[model samples]
Target: MANVLIIGAGGVGQVVAHKCAQVPEVFEKITLASRTKSKCDKIAEMLPRKIDTAQVDADHVGEMVALIEKVKPDMVINVALPYQDLHIMDACLETGVHYLDTANYEPPEEAKFEYKWQWAYHEKFEKAGLMALLGSGFDPGVTSVFTAYAKKHHFDRIKTLDILDCNAGDHGLPFATNFNPEINIREITANGRYWENGEWVTTKPMEEKRVFDFPEGIGEKDIYLLYHEELESLSKHLPEIERARFWMTFSPNYLKHLEVLQNVGMTSIEPIEFQGQEIAPIQFLKALLPDPASLGPLTKGKTCIGNIIRGSKDGQEKIYYVYNICDHQECYKEVQSQAISYTTGVPAMIGAKMMLEGKWMKPGVWNMEQMDPDPFMADLNQYGLPWQETWLDKPFR
Candidate 1:
């Protein structure tokens, strides 16, 4: 049993709180904190058991440190924004507590996100006898674990990897992002990148396009190539991987709205003077968009996110595929959130459990692939995001 302090009250944070509360044996006490305590309190009302809520600005190391001292939690689960990752990590280091986050850190002034920033803390964490886990979300979380699992059981050497993330749910809105609008828009508008022959290849936003037939009745959807942070860690950790790419599905309507928003400068991250004040257009746009939490009950259909890996086994070339299919309505029924939050949040809970249970505790910063995939994989099946595997005859084009 352990006490946990969760420092985000968005859709993902709600799912993490609910999932954590379900396993009282592992998460004995949970304190959900966010910038707005009301949001945390709202999520707390939905949980099976009562959890304490607090208001803390995770952007400030002082506020985070104070909260940790007050809560005295064994670990802090960060479902907060990517920009706050380091601040929370700093607090953990100061308080001598374990730390975990679903995404790597990215600078608030820049659109780029990578693992280099967080990876630098390994030496400090090791010296402090504290462990920090990064990128425990779905793609970075489950997808990275899937790669490690394949390398362990299915493949002796991994040659190529294509991570396909398809969210086919319809929220019935003209234009809305499944996650944070600013973060989502920044990632989509940024240049696309992939690794090949020990180098990175960059392309225009939404430049690379491919069609894939997803399993479990999701059918065919268009997937676009984008540089997700997982590719960086996977390539470094698995040196044998020659090529690794990440792809996501997007509808034409969504693309059209994004195009219009770009044309009007609504998606720009640069601050513009407005009424004697400066605000980024993207931030203003995020304010106009629907809160992602409200989309849970409105979303329908299913999501299929997994990896199509090509590698070798027993001196013979083979193709392997592993993925999980989650339904939006079903997730809402259980956790009051869509599959997007549920998928990301469930892995986060399991990751925290892995650390609390001492199955993955270590005195250093680590990625999902660096840990043993067996116990985490088993917990996935026992948890909400159950996965499936199949051997493919043809490679993903």
Candidate 2:
């Protein structure tokens, strides 16, 4: 039995709290915290098992340290904003508690996502005898594990990897995001990037597009290339990779709305004087948009996300596709969240469980691929997200 503290009361946090509570043998105590204590209380009320709730300013290391000391949690599951990642890591380091987060760190002033800031903590965590697991969410989380599993069980050398993420869920809203609107818009509006032949290639956002027929009757959707945090770690860990790219599907209506928002500068992260006060346009727009957590009851359809790897095994070239399809209604019925949050939160809980159970315990900063995928893969199936694999004679990219 172990105590776990989750710092985020969003949709993902709700799912993580529920999943962790499901496994009582591993998580004896659970605490949900956020800047707003009421949000934590709302999630805690839905949990079958009792959990503690607190208000914490995750942006302040001292505040987090105080909470960590009070809760005395074995580890901290950070589903908070990407900007707060460093602050939480600092608190974990000071308190000697383990750390895990879904996304990488991004400065609040700049719309950039990279692992360099987190990777800098490698020596600090090692010296402190603490463990920090980065990018344990669906894309960087499950995709990383799928690649590692393929390498261990099927492939000799993985030369090419295409990470395809498709969300067919419809919330019936004409222009709304599946996750945090500010974060989601910033990521999609940025330039697209991919790794090839040992260097990064940049392209205009949504410049490259393709159509793929997703398995299990998900059908074909238009997917666009984007720069994901996983490409960086996957390239470093899986050195044999020659080419790597990430893709996600978007509807034309969504694209149109985004283009209009960008043209009018609503998507801009820059601060502007509004009624003699400086405010970020994107943040203000986010306040006007619907909360992603509320989309659960209205969302329907499914999501397909996986990795397609091509390389040689046993002296012959081969290709494999591994992916999971999650339904929005099903996730809502189980945990009151859409598949996007469900996909991410499920892995966050599993990663934390692995650490607490000593299945992935180590003293250093690491990515999901650095750990053994066996336990994680098994938990994925046992949890809400079940995945399948297929052998392809030709590459999808």
The number of the candidate with the highest lDDT is 1
Clashes of 2: 0
Pairs with steric clashes in candidate 2: none
Task: List TM-score per model, in order.
Answer: 0.99, 0.99
For residue 165, what is the lDDT in candidate 1? 97
Supply every candidate's count of residue pairs whose N, Cα or C atoms clash at under 3 angstroms: 0, 0
lDDT of 2: 0.94
Stretches of candidate 1 off by over 4 Å are: none
Deviation in Å, model 1, residue 125 alpha carbon: 0.5
Error of 1 at 264 (Å): 0.9
lDDT of each: 0.96, 0.94
Candidate 2's error at 46, in angstroms? 0.5
User: Can you write out model 1's per-residue Cα lDDT over 1-397, one digit (the tens) per residue?
Assistant: 9999999999999999999999999999999999999999999999999999999999999999999999999999999999999999999999999999999999999999788889999999999999999989998899999999999999999999999999999999999999999889999999999999899999999999999999989999999999899999999999899999999999999999999999999999999999999999999999999999999999999999999999999899999999999999999999999999999999999999999999999999999999999999999999988999999999887
User: For candidate 2, lDDT tens digit of each residue in 107-210?
Assistant: 99998889999999999999999999999999989999999999999999999999999999889998889899999999999999999999999999999999
Model 1 residue 290 lDDT score: 98
